[model samples]
Target: MTSRHHNLQHLKNQAYQDPLTGLPNRRSLGDYLQTALDRLHRHAGQAVVMFCDLNRFKEMNDTYGHTVGDRLLVAITKRLQAALRPDDVLVRFAGDEFVVVLEQCGSRQQALAMAHRLKKQVGSTLHVDTAVLQPRISIGIAMTSDPLTAAADLLHQADLAMYRAKRQKGDSVEIYDPVLDD
Candidate 1:
């Protein structure tokens, strides 16, 4: 049946998504980020790439079944989306990692504020299914003032900042090392 086909397609899309969170997988994140970067470049504007990794996900996952973990991820994803501005994007990069893009950010301050908001959102306790989930996200902000920075480079910068964020706690948001080689 036609309805069956539509359902199947939807299922297929979900399969590529993070089963735990129902957010786009890293594979799709790469594609979408690239597309956004390209569009920004064409428009001669800056793009802000942010990487978010949950702080206490592994502890929760080991303590609970994947079902509970998945539910928690879903709740976290919704919270992140709700916190983002209309022009920004939030993606599930991986297990506890997420990627966000702020199109045409006017300043580092703007990016900083977004990261702080995301950190607060993720840090909030969530009621997922039958349990409460506590988690925080470390945010990494990468801003490219140059319109020519390719998508791959933008991702690389965001990833580097993500590691910097992981070194600490609560809410760490670091700008990319502009001095680094491209």
Candidate 2:
């Protein structure tokens, strides 16, 4: 490739990727969701959107410095990536929140299983330098096969589900239901 082409590609990557976690940023998530919606519209395939929030993240940040918090975030990112399939897309939404897009997810059960796997992986103890920290996450899942569903709607549903999970006793996962919409 030409030097100019390479530079442009690098710039595009930087624009879409989170600097700390190296996961896709929100902008990239929006674009990818649009494509996923279009594909679902065409093929009537199932896709799942998962919203994850770290529990007690602010407390962790307050106890440790941002430097340590940043390292913890990176560690969590690696675990998330490892838990997902190659085709699944993980986006660093903001701060301690992440969005995972699972394309061609066969069913809600499959998505829920994936969420459990991620929650288990993230809930493990993390060691940074001499400090050991236990991380917990609440996950919300929204599965869609409808062509008419909007990306924002899906995200909102997932967000609400995540909040519901957070309210529970431990690191939990909740699937979005019609009741959540109301």
Instruction: List lDDT for all candidates, in order.
Output: 0.78, 0.88
Clash-forming residue pairs, model 2 = none
Per residue, candidate 1 scores C-alpha lDDT tens digits across 1-182 of 99999999998798667766666777677666766667765675568899888877888888877778877778788989989888677778777788998877777887888888888877777876667777777777787767567777788888888777778554577777865434
* Model 2 lDDT tens row, 1-182: 69999999999999999999888999888777777777886675687899999988899888888988999999999999999999889999999999999877877778888998998888888998766999999999988898567899888999999998988764899998889767
Q: How high is each candidate's TM-score?
A: 0.82, 0.92
Which regions of candidate 1 fall more than 4 Å away from where they truly are?
A: 1-16, 42-44, 129-131, 178-182
Q: Deviation in angstroms for 44 in model 2?
A: 4.7
Candidate 1 is scored at a TM of 0.82
lDDT of 2: 0.88
